[model samples]
Target: MWDKQVMKPVSEPANSPSYVQVRLKLLRDIATGVWPLGGRMTLSDLEARYGVSQSPVREALLRLEGDGVVVLHPHRGAVVPQVDAALLTQVYDIIGALQGMLARRAVDHLTRTHLRELEAHLARFDAALDGGDIVGAVAANGAFHGMLNSLGGNPQAKALIETRFALAQATRRLVGYSSGRTAEVKQQHQSLLAALILGDGEAAAQVLVAHADTARDDLIARLLSKGAASTAS
Candidate 1:
């Protein structure tokens, strides 16, 4: 049984592969700050942590490594990247451009169904933020973009966006989320949706790019603040 401090664990989908289940759980743990950046988890420790065997754990780490979230040592363990300013800037830069690309393409293919789905995601985001559920809000926010990205119908671009998810999660977990940004996020989403509805791909892309830049800037500020605080302490 998970300890009391732990939130209820995410249940794996039925018949999922063992390694995939391990990977999801591992990602969740890392994203939630169970391990600090640059922390090492040896093969045995990971096997124990997730209550799985070595085979699946190794495979899972390989996948995360490929996604640029972890580094593997020969015959040893994995380490979460000790992210720096340059790395953060580079990752968010790529993420922003890809999201803008997808948002623009998303406009050309919108249907009533897709719009409704996007609205539902927005509602979920508002509710989460209202309740001060930062984790929930973040999850909903990801779902919102993920749905919009899908509507773009470019699997390659969508796949590239996903590869950055773990690294993005790490930055958010480290710097923390801001309710202060709520209004801006909501407005951006609303404006992007309106642009998509109006079939203005360029407008939607611009809004998305701006939205991404705003997010990146906020995280950078928070990250610097945390470092300063730690030094003072």
Candidate 2:
């Protein structure tokens, strides 16, 4: 059971402006897999945890329900939505398409300042990978991509990409089971950044596609390995 008063905000700023503070907290929990797939969530539980009134908690739950992150039930309150393979594929596919477009646009418009920021983000990603901070690495990866997509100057496309990226984050925890792949992922990011810096949209798009495909392959392999272990047992 969650106590609203005792609940500490995790991701949002201390002075978060949104009335949906509870919603933001819940979203973070779900995104990070702290809530886990199909885990039960309740309005009362959230209210107690964040020390907020039921209004905000309820509103947050409704928003999450709309976002497809949570499913509301008549008797069961809300539960984290499951991430099936089909949904995962769709999310990745959309991400790949949008990112491909973004990369193409970015190559022509990418400024020196943008490259510098990307390089700095890459350095942080490298450090996170070296330290085996999977979460940090994931965040840095998103930041780098978000920056690239924002530079594309298409708000509608960027909005869609952002949603797809969030879905990817939700599914990424499963793939992140392999720590050995961290360096390779980082190297891929470096390659993509280099391509972008050189104003080669085609190369950057290819690299991005390859990177996403590799991640999907790695995740499938992990799933197979788990199944094999289960059968052996």
Candidate 3:
């Protein structure tokens, strides 16, 4: 049994790969900024904290290191990588371009059913945000984009986007939303859907790029503000 304060139980089936599940939970926690950036954790600490054995915890940290989410220093152990302004700009730019490219191609393959599914995700996202369920909202937003990206019919492109998705998630905690920004997100979703419905690929692509750009700007601003505050204090 998991100690509630230290670990959350994984809901995966008993037959599933336990290590994968453990790794996923760790990834989610890190992505949501539950682990402080640049904070070090020893293998024993991770094992105890995640309620997993040494093997899985080690494997998870290794995998996270490969993904650039964490760095395994020889003497210091595993540390969550700090968010840097230049790195954020580059990653978000790539993400924005990928989103635009995917949206452009996806228009040709998307059907009415896909649009309906996206609409459902949008509703779920909006509801989660309104209820102040940040985790739920982030999950819903991811599902929405996952569905949209899947429609592109380019496996290679989709695969590349998935990598960037991981990078984006690591910094997701910084992208805090105001009420006005929440409304803006909803409007942007509607606009993208409208363009897609009309078979206006160019318009849809532009909307996708613009949406990513706005998110990038907001995140960078927040990070800067936080850095300044810490420096002042």
Candidate 4:
């Protein structure tokens, strides 16, 4: 169901190691469902996929395992657990609450420089949406949040939020988007931007949580449709 893939790389230090880069590439694939639920990813598959040697692949898997994104089996490869709709909903609920809190905190520290960066990402989102480019919109939306989440300055919370992103991306792949939803998302982005500019932490938090809530509904609706289609087929 990962029909579209959009990887927008953040700036990495020149000294960033190969293992880290491999890990990120692997994680991006996993997020977009290149690795299916319950699927096994052998070390050989990874090495071949990334054109990397054994050590970097092993280390990358280790990092993902630590993040709960994969589970390693001795002499076997890492396995992606099937994250069901119910569990995904719970994950989103937690994400919504945590990100809402992060949005609230971000207000105290958001500066003009940060706002300008955010505005750029937001403009990208609007452009993508206007052009009916969902994949581009998804990437732009992520860049916007990546910028916003950084504003919280809470690494612990940020890490927690990030671990669950792949599942959400998987949901996006399956659901795609209904007509008019992009407009709603654009409105929410506008509202959130306005709230942050006004230093209205509560308003910003509310909009973010609402955004997550919409995602939850989208996942449910799409999966149900998939089920119905399967039944008919």
lDDT of 2 by residue, 1-233 (tens): 11244321123256864445766667656666777776887667776777888667777778767766678886556888766656666766777888888789877666677789888888887888688676777678777887888776565676566655565676666556476567678778888988887899999989888887776666656656765788999
Off by over 4 Å in 4: 1-21, 36-39, 51-56
lDDT of 4 by residue, 15-132 (tens): 7788888877876787667887668999899899999898998998898888767899977989987666786788788789988998898887777777888999999988987887
Off by over 4 Å in 2: 1-27, 48-63, 174-180, 227-233
Clashing pairs in 3: none
The TM-scores of all predictions, comma-separated, are 0.80, 0.74, 0.74, 0.81
Tens-digit lDDT track of model 3 for 1-233: 22244222223366656666666677666766667666777777777777878777777777767766678876556888777777777767877788788788778766677789889999999999899877777778887887777676555565556555655665665555655668888899999999999988889889988888887777777778778989999
Error of 3 at 67 (Å): 4.1
lDDT of each: 0.78, 0.71, 0.74, 0.79
Q: Looking at model 4, which ten-residue stretch has the lowest summed lDDT?
A: 1-10
Cand. 1 TM to true fold: 0.80
Tell me the lDDT of candidate 3. 0.74
Q: Largest TM-score belongs to which candidate? A: 4
Query: Per-residue lDDT tens digits of candidate 1, residues 172-214?
Result: 7667666567788889989988998899988988998888888
Better of 3 and 4 by TM-score: 4
